[model samples]
Target: MSKTQKPVDELSAEEAADELAALAAEIARHDRLYHGDDAPEISDADYDALRLRNAAIEVKFPELVREDSPSRVVGAAPSGTFGQVVHAKPMLSLDNVFSDEDVTDFVASVRRFLAFPADRELAFTAEPKIDGLSMSLRYEGGRLVTAATRGDGTTGENVTANIRTIDEIPQTLPADAPDIVEVRGEVYMRRDDFIALNERMAETGRTFANPRNFAAGSLRQKDPEMTRSRPLKFFAYAWGETSAPLAETQFEAVRRLGSWGFRVNDHMAICRSVEEMLARYRAIEAERASLPYDIDGVVYKVDRLDLQERLGFRSRSPRWATAHKFPAEKATTVLNAIEIQVGRTGALTPVARLEPVTVGGVVVTNATLHNEDYIKGIGQNGQPIREGRDIRVGDTVLVQRAGDVIPQILDIVPEKRPADAEPYVFPDKCPACGSHAVREEGEAVRRCTGGLICPAQAVERLRHFVSRNAFDIEGLGEKQIEFFFNNEDPSLRIRSPAEIFTLKARQADSLTKLENIDGFGATSVKKLFAAIDGRREVPVSRFLFALGIRHIGETNAKRIARHYLSFEALRRGASEAEIPQGKGDPGNSAWQELVGINGIGAIVAEAAVEFFAEAHNREALDALLKEVTPVDEEPVGDVSSPVAGKTVVFTGALERMSRDEAKAMAERLGAKVAGSVSKKTDLVVAGPGAGSKLKQATDLGIEVIDEDQWFERVSG
Candidate 1:
């Protein structure tokens, strides 16, 4: 709300998306700094400000919030030193409410769900939200046993040794405590101690961005002595796993936590209404700056544990509780330049190169422009979008990241734009391979036309060849494909799919062995060779899919395989159909026959033909086939029968054959199975409870058969 850019309401969908990406990047950096390193660069207030802005933008753009926003997640990735720990119960994230209206809506939604009367009281426990790492300390038999960071909710890094050094966390709980308990809360450093720690770092020629990062980094040190040397405190505000109930209400649980010799937040209170809840938040905010440790906002939870259970959870966060986050920080910088990165699929992605600026404590260098249209500010209709504003190099742009973790360019200041700045021209050729890059009709992306020659496309195709649905080779994966493809020596490099099968023989006489590679061991190398050899004979459908031909997906490949029955037959047929010279009618040309198969459209047929038309592709196929054989597609039922190669649709409830069994049987008999009934459908097997499909079949005047008749037709 305080930035130089237009209000979230005034921005176009493209502009809003750009802003949201920036916020996400910025927020993620802060999370890593505070939770991962315990060294937050931004103050509690500044960080909170970014979060508040993020919520505002999200409120205006709900669909955009979902892209990269980590609003629900609480902690950063666990440090590498400690071994991992899986929690008995998942430590879920919490939803955030940034305004009083949001708070009011949250309460109202709860009451409406439970059908509670207006007079019914809904008490909530309101407490300061600590700016520190979330830890789950597991205690069994009233003794502190295991301590872990809330790493991605389900699992965390084991920090048991470092946790034992914290004075506030009792070494042992009361004898009357539950037999097993996992106390969940924040581990923070007091203001005085943080200042002292900073002073020590300065004297020792070491530096941390802020107290939060220092606290997080200090707490997760590999050396237990180093952890003990630092002054750290804990506030047990929640619990993860407990053998028995801690209390009936949330308020009572905090008190129970205190009675168990664990340090609990002293500022917690019971707020029976939304007004009371917001008042508590205000009270906390008033004294936030003076607090010994950082408090970004306040968390409010439904007091009654039963109501909390009834509210349950969404996919990721709790329904009965929400954190009231503050706002995010923002800054302005010059747009240095725009760079394009070629993805595996060959689409060039535009990235913003920005002068480094600090947003919520992270040094922001790059922000995603998303696409060429985003950089040029144009819509699909070639109309001016984003109010006709285009980003250019040497222009001053507003960079903002609302606690969303990513930084984005909000807007460019026209007055600050360089007088001689030139418009960015998106390259029409592949930056990597120098091939013609063209975008097809009805598609937004421009891809490099050089699929076979392009190194980027080649690597991706190799990956697809060995993917699970394709070859499914055990040990040969993307890394191996990359390593083998990118080998510096000319003869050793794997240039095509055929080379993968010839690796063992090629390396047999060479001084260097695959087993001698860094990642490969004797057992792995043997397994890799065995896996490659095992795939010598494979299903035709899998082999076709493994070719990595454009637009020929799994279903299309299966349909094509069923149509041709064998690799040689398919290759000859595809090679003969040189161009788009076919009709989608049965008993036509080979191209027409391919197009006639259900789900195999002209586009897919053309792609297959195009692949075969190339002499190099034909050569590659010949070389690969010499080493391996694709088993002819075996008839599912009887390919020579009347119903063979027919497109059959089974609708409604079948009395004899189950839906899956019927489909499988149809495929076994060499029938092309389809889910829906249409003009292309040759036969419709209608059973009882047959609805629209049956009527449509009858209306189309297509042959309609019953379960018994269908079996008879197949058997006869």
Candidate 2:
């Protein structure tokens, strides 16, 4: 169950009904976020819990099932570029029931809905819900005909060519099979395959957020060959359309599908009672972490075909079926201390340092407290809420990692609180610059005082912005960065990276000419302008890195920039994160999406979001963008380039460009660079300091070249 949600039995009918509406709306939003954008904010376990809560509520108040109940929805409507195809039969969704009571209620509801005798014998079958894209395969006359996705249940996208490439999917079924059959199942990438694909993507500076999205994006590629490159497998769990009756029982139909060479999950069984059904669900949940693919829940369906038909469906979900989900990842840990972090913008974010505990396969020693209010259990409206329970130091708190990589304190266990536990007092002063940390009305975060005196934070940022790993401006060395940063003359001082672009404009209004400045000359000034203009169009990844958000380093920044691809798209995602979500969740949806990236944790996501949240930060970025447009992130570099998959070394002074530039270029060509040359070094570019490395390369028979030769070959 969701941490924020009240138990179904505990809620009044009206409250339960309202909760159902909220849950339904929340699930739909998630569907669009995950299905439409391939960016899901919550984890599978978290999402399933929401659906489970919705089901439990509906079970308590069956009549309150909304028209938009998520139970009825199949996979998010396939809103893709592929041409559309309508399923012969709608790909109906199964209702979900989380607990034993919900399962018992489901069986009882089926009997009541069918008007069957209480004593009548009934059987049900359970199967794992593969966490993958749903594809409907249509075969005509024992030959492959068409393949489609479960788009909006009734409509689907045509992927016949792509599906044909999967060796697991048979082009032609057994000769004895029905003339027409639509094999419905999931198209998935195995766990090992997913890990390998991610590793390969990372080596090339590209990556996938998760396996399900990777499979969906891969299978839906415009070019079928692209889909063929992905290692995707399929499992036939159910059928959509058939020319002849396959069997009377659901188990028999699945067996017949297996007999025809269709892969079916081995962990399936017929359950005689709700207890047996619950046992199966527990068993699946236990084995879930080991499964190669993902399954959000275990789906149970009535075994008898006639009975299933009689039970039919209630609006969107079949009354004969319900999915029992696994519990989300949650654990109790000591709240060792609360550490306060002052970001670039001076926002004092409270971070929870906890006793090491594992949640969702990751050791979590740190979690976000979000704000001081969260520790005090203050509601968004400033009223006391969540039973007015404040999270105290030394409290045994519930830490949970939902679809988010960052763990959070769900609630405090008052009973387990330490005797010496004391209320945490949030600092009113900035911890970094010793300035006033003031909170504005209607804002949850506090900001540090800003001025010339406290420009320490901005100064550090300026240094990073011009570092070789960032924008790598040739003329903008540390001395220049510091000089211009504290320029004494207000007209020339740069407060942010964006102001760097406006230097020429700022200089134009000054009485002093840059060329006449003591250390600068006509030639030097021109060279400086050339360097600045040369980078007028900066790479998006470098641009993002130059901003210097907390926890976001070069690698993650590059990943984020490439993922968003454009400055405008990245800004929009940040802006959208502030909008209200389904249940007043501060939305943080875009933040959640950002966190979904493999290495992007909650802390990093929060930093990015906070950086964007500030009006000053946004203004500075906008000003910089007006002067210089950030280039779209480059695609994963040429893996087949000449230097691809080779190790190289640069052991001397580089005259053509900075060593950073050489490394970037070599990496772009898919080459591994090492500090020391050995037998593994395919080539060595030795310059002025050639000394030891030169002799070593000669002795090791490693290819040795000069700067001129190195540049000549790359250009060639």
Candidate 3:
């Protein structure tokens, strides 16, 4: 065979493999600094060049790719606070090319390959790449169906229940629409919302490092209510599978999406040629910092749908799309303190609390300290850490964020620290609980032995139980619930979350007396009671989740409930189990058996076993059961019926049907109407202004049904 050009043979197989791993590690380090950390050593153009070079090298040596490579990964792992979801389609990273030369080369490559005439201009659509979580939304028969993260391409975690809470995502579609439509977009926390969220976190002694992380963490929450509480907005940028084409060109498709009430990216430009595309890219680069939200880059896509298909894709990214990233933001800030935080799993993270500093217009206050090893390398002694010395307390440090989300601490400044400063001291006991804390083998955290009694654990766990994912008690926010529970010690101890349910019966007079307290009016008190009353009958999945078993998230809870069928059965089964398993239930086999069921992991199973073993937890559960009931499994809806057995999510504004009315109608028709869409979604009823759920539906290839058609079919 004649070779057009010999591939670079500078490195042999072993050498190339080693270098590839090193490159991936280096890039991932930089990615943490850029995307997660918000600090970059390189300029926008330089970073783009580096990424491009990496991509080129990887492209040439495809076998060197690692499963965890930054180039192959789309978003960071989901935060521990929310339930995780895998996406149906892998959220692929975009390829970026900088400078006019790069754009011209790209155009040349497309033209030469497609055999287009030089005079024939390639109409390219340009839009701002919103620096937020990329999501897919599905709509069937004009009603919203499901929303999901762009996971590993074939499957993703179901986030449909949570996505429904975003008001910006329309719950229904216009009077007329396609049978199936999927819309793809970004879910972003606005600048103001991000600031407010951080402020709230600060007041509660919690922290939100940046807006992008906050947005991603919020959007992925198991509780739709929590996602809705954050000021999350969606801007439709692309489409997934469609029964019929919405428009011919990318510009027209975006316009139609807007017309159909989708929040299309407002900052978009039409470029007629590669030169124009370059100009637009540069213009966006210049104006990146000035935009209301963060944007790491500008994106260019093939205008024609057929052309995009023809161009096809590589193993990781699409051939049709590319992102032109701006420079990474970099700045210096004083390392005020290094504080350790315990996550739900008891991972102790060292955070470099910094003096407020701005990079790329956004102010940053904290950066990741990594771990004890990183801390020691940075120097623990009073001596100031130079770049060579790593970092030390009271030293000035460099910071960066990529796409303006994560915050990373760079080198330390020795010149700024006082001569008498001492090395930072690691704490031996839990800061919140003051319990005898010990760092377990193979773990980074020094955990308190307080268990359920720890104030922080008790408060946080209580919050989680009533969170949007659990009992979903409305009117009881994090602060309000904490205020009530935290104060119980002086008067009485609230040992369990089920105590909240029994309060109405045991403390009806006290509850009335609460209205007379400062800042507590009768209206507010009534609202709280009403909210509590509304949630007396929660779904089995939610009830299981509300127990606050470690690692037993919404997905696991659902699976466990489905397997056992009833709480009595589950409790009996767990009691009969001989060994400890999932979630570590302190070496209890019964706990292991619970998690061994489908969708239940060892982490969750152990937690359930541990919780049931605790006398306090069992007592609390009994109290809760007295006040509330779990949602029972409904009989299967008739498959012959149009809406039967299908999970339907609603989005956007609906003129003909109120959302509640539609949900009621769906129930009346024996349809299993759901708040969010997942892999199980049968149809999505979309409306004008339908948001990410529309994209999720189309991507899954589930039917998208519109309201008018829905009315017609169901009514008939």
lDDT of each: 0.78, 0.76, 0.67
Off by over 4 Å in 2: 1-26, 44-75, 115-119, 202-209, 332-355, 360-716
Q: Please identify model 1 stretches exceeding 4 Å from their true place.
A: 1-97, 100-335, 343-345, 354-367, 395-416, 472-483, 488-491, 515-524, 554-589, 596-598, 631-646, 649-671, 674-716
Give per-model TM-scores. 0.50, 0.48, 0.58
Clashing residue pairs in candidate 2 are 42-403, 43-403
Name the candidate that leads on TM-score: 3
Candidate 3 off by > 4 Å: 1-124, 130-250, 253-264, 271-294, 300-323, 342-349, 370-390, 413-423, 488-495, 505-512, 580-595, 634-716
Candidates by TM-score, descending order: 3, 1, 2
- How would you encode candidate 3's per-residue C-alpha lDDT over 509-625 as one tens digit per residue? 453366676766789878887888899887677888777665565555665775565777788777665553345444443443354353345555556666777787677777778
Q: What's the residue-level lDDT of 536 in candidate 2?
A: 82
Q: Order the candidate numbers by lDDT, best to worst.
A: 1, 2, 3
Question: Cα RMSD to native, each candidate?
Answer: 17.9, 20.7, 12.9
TM-score of 1: 0.50
- Write candidate 1's Cα lDDT for 382-461 as tens digits: 76755778888898987765222345676788888889998888889988899998866766566787777899878877
Name the 10 consecutive residues with the lowest summed lDDT in model 1.
199-208
